[model samples]
Target: MREPVDARRTRILAVVHARGAVKVSALASELEVSMVTLRRDVEELARTGMLRRGHGVVRPMGDTGPTTVPAARGDEPVGEGAAVGLVVPERHSYLYETLHGARTALEEAGARITLHIAPQMAGAERPQVERALAAGVHGLLIAPRWRSAAGEEADYGWLAEVGVPTVMMERRPRPGSVLHAMDTVCSDHWYGIHLAVDHLISLGHRRLVLAARNDSPTARSIRAAFAEIAAARPEVEEWSVVLSSPNAGPGEPGTLEEAPDLTAHLRERGVTGAVLHGDEDALMLVQRLTENGIGVPRDCSVVAYDDVVAALASTSLTAVAPPRAEIGRAAAELLLYRLGRPTGTTGPVRRTELLPRLEVRGSTRALLRPAD
Candidate 1:
């Protein structure tokens, strides 16, 4: 049963006047009202000049007392009580850091976060998003598991009309598509791949091989970027792409299994340099190479794609480290700006990209010259 509007506002104003200031979450809980209902009441009261709504806190107009709430993140205030939904694929350590970054930023800005992890399967994100929407989230941050263009397009129509501020993390929509107009923040993977390939070429490596997964959007992008980079470079003598794992088929990304060891193949093909996607695959392949009497940086140079565990490898694998956390922070900040927009004004869509860096380690070295 809905409480009478006058009664609710009377109680709300009483609490604010008594406490001098209160967080939106605490106020809503005290009033035993839904956030949606509380937001409507607050908006109404603010319009009638009864209260002030800013910095995600409600306070009486003349009240200047200190708030019990902790200091917020940035100097600027995001609207109080804003809750956002975070959806990511399961078991993605790379994205887990992204989630943490977003959580920190939102919590610092005085916003609430509702997290939902999509299971590793096709069409898992929609239901989770529906749940968030039903619960009245003000915004969303999603890293959809897109294995192919078709897979991504299937979600575009519905996602574009989610009716709230949304920022995609580490995912890019197709050019001119409906989602292309949506806000997004992703690391420049092409630039990351280029950094790895260029690093290898500068070390006098001509023959290169890339063993990478073909399961997710990042994996597909890395594969294509490697092919384009290797083909475009006249310095590259031979390059090839092989499955890093045979577990996930090209069409489905549920099972990520390791591919057969390629130690003998690398020897037969005279490949002196290799780039491996993901930290685990690189570590495992390097172990296999060592078992076959091939020493890293001596017989074969390796560059791992993800840096999550690359630094922990026995050889301390050199890696292209994407700005995983920044992607989330940027996305969250953008969404907050959208949420706090002055009424009757909508902002332009934004697509932001952060650069990745090369972490040089013991895994790569300059090739031995004949003179030496």
Candidate 2:
């Protein structure tokens, strides 16, 4: 006698109900079927609003409404029918402005957003997306941890498999990964770096230094772009690039002091111009150089990436302004589009990249001529 598939599914679900929760892998093992097959069943159940899938477990729908709560201390209302999850690395003071800007944009369109703490999605993210999934939000916006592109693919795949549409903010999937098939919203990193480097070079700075995190795809891209442009200039006598080590702990004082130390390492090599990957790092370098008695733009010039106020506050940081607020809005738009809740409309798979703009501020100056 052939057992009916629906009957088997009913029985499987009944067992799940009896247990209150069950892992998908375990269900597949029990049914002697592939995980893919089991996942399809779960998807059907999810589509029908019967259950919600998590990382390793499934929960019954059981009359619980979508997990939308009143505005908490750090959050504001995003409005109706549009529920999105924000998976950020960590909560910093600056994030509030970015999130608020996004909230304002989405609220105007009547979208509601719930912020979740998902630090794993940062540089070395954890497979901890289950809690956000159980909430059964309409969409997800991930600011995934910066790591190998392969890791990025795995994380996105995990989210997609759970039937929630996802968009990555600031990070893109590795090219050729199945997850890369999805859309992303990223800054025009290469062009931004080009402008930053060119601006410093034009200030009579013959030597240039590019500081970046080693092996970072975004950082690597920026470095390669700068290198290409620098290679074309003959007047620039020397240039040096180095990936800063995290080992330079916060406690390390005066590491940049003197011409024979870090600065000297660069000076000995005749490297004067400097471009930094992020404002945070740029400020760090500027402080180090100042501690070493080197004057910015005179002894060295520094440009920051991501024109956050923290970067601009420093007198020596001329920085490229990344559209952080705009990126957040774009990410929200992607999530809404996926949920069939576009701003004043809806659409199919959508993706976009915004160009970054260089803001010349007080930190840069033309090198002074030698005293006659």
Candidate 3:
């Protein structure tokens, strides 16, 4: 009953070849389909070098083969200057550093990089990705948005249908689910949690709390790792405080108006150490605790997960720094490797996991107790 994907794509190419140049709307009307579906087919065809795309029209690739608009120029063959698309959620410091690393690697490989920013919403990335594919990118590096736990099983069937080699950046399918069969480069978040917990326990912290955003994927990983480690050490007391509200503003997740009184909560739970999932949250918590006359590193030791703001904070934070640049470089290398290989010749799915390093600063110290 449903039309086959290849069949639809074939029809699109036929139409494009016949007309030389066809507007997306006209094609949709001719095929009796919605513009979204038509555009998807066109994008796929363009990605495979079967067609080229302009503003809103599709054209058959010239006899010279697939046309690519390079981001930069260099003394290399046209194929060596192939363009690669990178789609990320936002242009934050961590992501920017990652992009820089990717750019460095791509340049070395004589490839050009094009960037697209996808909004942090469900299904919003599809359009941006389609646009990149239509622009004739040789490959793609993407950090897809997984908006909710219910949508964790989202698949990349569309990506495969497009026939472009893609490498996921710092993201992966949920555990126990079938792997997405794509290359991936991500930080070892579970090990980062271990480093934080081990450091706290070694510093005489028996009672610990993990402060995190409940809806964040990274937070979920940290929480799971904390639970596993806590279960193994029954003598230690561990708890988690989840921030249920959305981020207050750009780069500010813990400054919500409805933020709970962490001082009172920590006092009641007898938490002597805390591992916050974000630098913003940890910095805010430290300020709040200081305002309440609690001395940091004296009354409580804090470790932030993301190191973005660790050194910037008034009291430099002991934090886990993810290998941001390395992730980018690795992702670029994987994508370029895929591009160099023949279609379907990539023997095995590649997955690279870089470890996060813990940086000790003034915010945390060995907890000293009065004479027993």
TM for every model, in the order presented, reads: 0.79, 0.66, 0.73
- Tens-digit lDDT string for candidate 1 (1-372): 867999999999999889888888668878898666887899899999998877568889997654345533343333565778999989989999998889877876668789999987777899999999999887899999876666788999899889877899999888889999999999899999999999999999999999998877888889899999999999999998888766533554444445656797788888889999888888888998899999998989999998999999878999999999888888988887787665435568899999999999999999887786
lDDT tens digits, residue span 1-372, model 3: 899989888888888789777656457768887656776777788788888885455788873433433332232222245689998776355677788888888865557678998776666677888899899887898876554444445445465565677888778666545556677898889899889988998999988887776444566677788888866776576665555224621233343434466787789888888887677778887888999978788889999988988889888999999998889999998887777555556779887899999999988998888862
Clashes of each: 1, 12, 0
Compared with the true structure, all predictions reach lDDT values of 0.85, 0.63, 0.74
Estimate, for each residue in 1-372, the C-alpha lDDT of model 2 and write its tens digit.
866779767866886777666655456668776555677787788788777765445667772433333321222222234466777666443344456655665554445567765452333344445666777666677765444434444566565575556776766666666666566787778779878877877888887877765433465567677787777778667766665545321112332312124466666776667787555666777778888888776677778776665344548478887677887777776665455433333344555788889888777888776771
Query: Considering every candidate listed, which one attains the maximal lDDT?
Result: 1
Query: Residue 304: error of model 3 in Å?
Result: 0.6
Q: Which of 1 and 3 is the better model by lDDT?
A: 1
Winner on TM-score between 2 and 3 is 3
Order the numbered candidates by lDDT, best leading: 1, 3, 2
Which has the greatest TM-score?
1
TM-score of 3: 0.73
